[model samples]
Target chain A: MVEAEAELKRLMLAGLAGDAAAHRTLLAAVARHLRNYYRARMRGAPEDAEDLVQETLIAIHTRRDSYDASYPVTAWIYAIARYRMIDHFRRHKRRGGDHIPLDDAPELFTAAEDQASDARRDVMRLLDTLPAKQREAIQLVKLDGMSVKDAAARLNLSESDVKVSAHRGLKALMKLMADAGP
Target chain B: MKTDDLIDALARDPAPPPAPPAPRRMAFALGAGLLLGVVLLVTFFGMRPDIGAAQMPVMMKAMFSALAASVAVPVLLQLAKPGRPLGWRIAAVGGFVLLSAGIVGVALIGGDPTERFQLWMAGAFPWCVAIIPLLAAPTALLLTRLLRDLAPTDLRASGAALGAVSGGIGAMVYAMYCPVDSVAWVVTWYSVAIALCAVLGAFAGARLLRW
Candidate 1:
């Protein structure tokens, strides 16, 4: 976790320096973390977790300039995420809706774990449906901890070609995942 | 949008946004508005003519307005940026409450008790109330501009704080021309005007600050 935090901070700083790859990597990693973060907090409203994750990611992009370099990157990200959650709560409170059940404490904990595993399975299933080349490209570059350059060298492809494959693969997966949702 | 699409859209923006210096930006905007308010004050209402007799009262009003401003400015600066700790928020509220209570105490000791309500209501019935928010308009414009790009977590509260600060600065500008010498008048009427601005700011912030 400590190493992950440090790596995120480094990638974010690099992103601020106009490194697009770093920016993409940081956002991808942060999205996973945020999914877990919101899932833990939003028990009854499991669906809202994904929405909050996207909102936080967008906020991180737009408000990148407000981030102070002196602070821990996770601190900055968590603050924005927390604020976004508060906004969600405020909106729901004003509308007189209760998606977050305070009374179902034990059930919420069980539901959170079940939802998280179901989400992981759903993601894996989405990845499984992609073309072989694109799936290999994504797994090598994104899931298997291989740099695009190394992954390209291993796959006997150009670096840019590998990047395009991974990018398309992710986009396709997102569309598939969204379509597969209830 | 899905997280991936959101990420793609974010990375697609070519130019890296440089972090804005929030405090300096706020100061510049409010300072520019203060200059405009001062110009208006001198042109229309001119400073109180009796400088000798009005020294202490003028000084008191200045102190109160400035103190309120001092508390509010930091709150605006801090709240405008996410991830910043609002330790100053507590201090700001404490200072405001203490200052208000102290003003009441002064009203009790130095002020004529019988005429306090009369002076508070009568001296600046409509003009003092109306003028502060009018003067705050320019500063509010400046604030809105500065806060446009920045993300405030709580828009309503941040807006109210900005409005209150703008009002305090406006009242300070008005104090130079206001002839009323009573502490009750300055505390009561100026506060009402400032509070009105805060309410206005809350509504405006809620709509305008939505990202």
Candidate 2:
């Protein structure tokens, strides 16, 4: 564990000094660790765990300057991860557990279909609350599964702008969802 | 989006342009804020008419305010970054508070009992408390912006520290126009004003400092 901490710290410091390759390596490693951390805590919700892993990684990347050399890199990463997880749970609680399971084998297929459509409806409703650009960016890139290049071309925005809008849109969605809850 | 794809996107984005070290950035921000506060001070209140004759008290006020700022500035910088142990810095802030209290205690004990109330109230009680925070506004706003750029895990604590440091600057500027020489009055009212700034900072920080 200590060796892992040292290696991660070294990579993080190098990454902060404009070493893009080192940053990529560090992020990949951090993502692996976050997956396990969230998976263990969020049993039976692998998709949610993956979503959190992505959210935490984005946070770590955006806020990299906040990292201080005096502390272990894992400690800093986990602190951010913990914050994201708490935020996730808060939003999750507000949404409430509305999922219903149909146990009969004959109904199982239809139930899955129903859930997917219900999820799509919920997403569209939430997306409507975002700014037009953010909503469009997320719809094309995230929901429609378009590449950033394609989405950017369609929207007349730069590729980075598409990514940024999607990121911001997701953050806003989380906030909106949390507020929607009691 | 898949986690791996998201990672790739994040990595592909360019690294932020190089930033000045934390201490340098902090110094620049606070210095600029102080300059604004001083400009406001001179334009409005002007220096105390008797500033030349009130050298002793003015110097004393400057010393106390400077000491407070010295204690707060480092801690504020420390709190702006995450994962650093604040044990010693927190202790140092506690020590400064004790020292301020000690000065007040000595003044109260050594002075005549009949003048105790006068010493506490001194001149410009209302103005001191009100104007210090008013002057601190620029510094507080600047520090908040800086802290947002930097990562602060505990928003409320960071905000309170920001407030305290700005309040110190405000008190320092207020001292130039404050003619009261009583150590008790300076210690008591200045501390109160600084605390008020801190409370306001905590409220603002909690709302504004989220990542």
Candidate 3:
């Protein structure tokens, strides 16, 4: 993992030179890389998370040759993952549920007001009150299957802070749900 | 909701029917780009000395390169995939801008019909390097959306390849209608200009257009 990118470059050069076997080998390894890449980014459940990885891998395999040798493969790969996540949210919105924002670009923050509505109506219905950022941390890390580090990166907070936030968010949410007295 | 419960809520939600109307809009972008490429081509041929004249190869070589870049930029931007899908308005906008680039090239090349068009190419050739993307964002968005729709299992590569080729056609079309007679001239001056537009479009789309 430490020298993974360097190794990938060597494999890519081999593929460019028309090594068919090298291309297959590189493709297989990148699939694993894609899964881990996605896992860290998502802060949700395990089930759909793997599906996202597989879908992204399919995208990479289908379009691998387009990977510019001049660019970093890792960022290119993550960009694909990020788009798929957006696609996922769009699909979810169609199903009558709340959607999440995967804000990779400034232009993509369309309908911030709508997302806020969704947060108040749906997310608050479940968690009672834990503040927006705390709820987001729980949503991204616990349910979305994103690791603390990746969620922290997305949230622009230290990992320790996110850990604390998630802890508090979960505790408060549980108490709120429990107090509903079912 | 519990974490899994929330996940379940999201998962159980049904995906909407495929937005079939979107593809037609995307195809429209492809068509617009193709039209622009054809325009470049037409202007380029119009600039040729005459249909029957013996065409010199060296000048032809330089002209073709210029023509190719002008064409590639709009098409490449459309085919790029960084974010949400592109729409028809974007395609229409790109077509308009690429058309303007062809017009600009026409102005510069319409002079001195006796001069060999290729010689001047070396001097003003790389200008397309700056303009293609700057003024042609709609075209870039068009290309990006076009590529995403063409993501078929087997024909994906074909989609990308066709995008580049067809885009060149649109650029060429714009070139031909430039009111210039020397194909070499249009290819020399105008082709270089549009190609610069294409490069700019692709670079901007990479970041600005990414989802």
True contacts kept of each: 0.53, 0.44, 0.03
User: Highest TM-score among the candidates is held by which one?
Assistant: 2
lDDT of 3 at B38: 44
TM-score of each: 0.66, 0.74, 0.34
Better of 1 and 3 by TM-score: 1
Q: In model 2 chain A, which range of ten residues has the least summed lDDT?
A: A91-100
Q: Candidate 2's residue-wise lDDT over A114-179, tens digit each?
A: 657655655565565466789899899988999999999999999999999999989977765553
Q: Per model, how many backbone clashes are there?
A: 0, 0, 58
Give the poorly placed runs of model 3, Cα more than 4 Å off.
Answer: A1-79, A82-182, B1-3, B19-25, B32-138, B144-170
Evaluated on the second chain alone, the candidates' TM-scores are 0.84, 0.94, 0.41
Over A1-182, each residue of candidate 3 has an lDDT whose tens digit, in order, gives 44677877777667556665565566567657756766776667555666665555445544454455665656556667766676556545534324544553442444465666544433444542356577889989988999999999999999999999999888867654443222
User: Ten residues in a row with the worst lDDT in model 3 chain A?
Assistant: A120-129
* Interface DockQ of each model: 0.22, 0.23, 0.04
Candidate 1 stretches with Cα past 4 Å from truth are A1-7, A39-51, A70-72, A82-182, B5-9, B12-20, B39-60, B112-126
Better of 1 and 2 by lDDT: 2
- The CA lDDT at B14 in model 2 is 65
